[model samples]
Target: MSNSNLNSSSNHFSCPKGGAGYVCPDEPQFVGCCSQDPCRNVDANSTSPCPGSNLYYASYDPFIHEEIPANACIDGGKWFTCTGANPSFIGCCASDPCKSPDHTGCPDDDLLPAAWSKSRPGQFALFQDEGTADDDELSGGAIAGIVVGAVAALVTIGALVWFFVRRRGNKAAAMSGHRHTSSVIEGEHRRMYPCPASPSFISSWIGAI
Candidate 1:
């Protein structure tokens, strides 16, 4: 190849199919010579890079009928595409978290895209609210309450039993005291009654003597 042709070839941007090129910050792939308009110069039918070769076209438009847009070629992170309408920003340029670095196809997020703003925030919020140790703490408190309640119930039962036993003992003592009082009354009556009647008769006889 001539030096001029070599220079021209060197100036041209060559990348593997579905491969990414040098990306300038805040610049879309369509802004430079690799834009959709420039790719039209190359034929879309051939796979080899020769003069009048459709390899450029084949590279530009892999599926013959549809032309791959310049913006689609730019690496817009892993899952997202940087379109002309919604160009990728610096913050959005990182590798996809869900896909491996070797992966070339669209990310799973893109194939089955989530409602990013709605689903992620809500999921994280729910995790924040319900994913703590509070449940375990609450269960511990409940167990403590049950244990205290059981102890209190046992103490109450013991006190009731003691009170009933003391009451029965007091009743038995009162019955014994009543029986002793009746016996003392019968003994006093036996000692005084006959003495009274005999003393009266004897006093009369002694006065006659």
Candidate 2:
């Protein structure tokens, strides 16, 4: 009852020869498979008791082949098997949203491997690493947008700084020209009106005039 090559698409599967196979009619023995009559003899060449039936290939010996109930997956997930070293447990595939730190293994963009659990009496859980196929593309686009926005901000700041600096330079040049013009006008006024040689000479000249 080695489930290494278990088919996830079809519900029914075949059991190998000399293996603990053939699920009985009783529900307690195997709940996933269909039951056959006790009087009918099982064919040695045939692998399944009821061929082409949509049922789990659970063997009569519960220990050998684990029995997974029909309602095991509450969220309508299909049963599958892991390909790696963790094939002993039955894996459930579904399109449900998966939470972090526990869920892993994305089969498709929508389908995700919910969890790997044993179909036996007790459940054992195992999870694989998450795939980042589409995430990479999204991250790249985000990074590019950030880079473009930063460049635009830098260009705007540079333009503002240049305008302010040019305006300050123009104002300083105008103030310098005004001071030079006032100095020239004061020089001409001093030349036009010369000072008297002495105070006494200035008094005599005023009286004569």
Report lDDT (CA) for all predictions.
Answer: 0.32, 0.36
Worst 10 residues of 1 by lDDT: 52-61
Error of 2 at 41 (Å): 37
Sequence-dependent TM-score of model 2: 0.33
Where does candidate 1 clash, by residue pair? none
User: Using lDDT as the measure, which candidate wins?
Assistant: 2
The TM-score values for the models, in the order shown, are 0.30, 0.33
lDDT of 1 by residue, 1-209 (tens): 10111012332222333222222212121212122222222245522112111111111111111111112233233223222111111112234422434434333232211111221222212112221123223334456899999999999999999999999999999999999999999999887765455787989999999
Model 2, position 53, has a per-residue lDDT of: 27
On TM-score, the leading prediction is 2
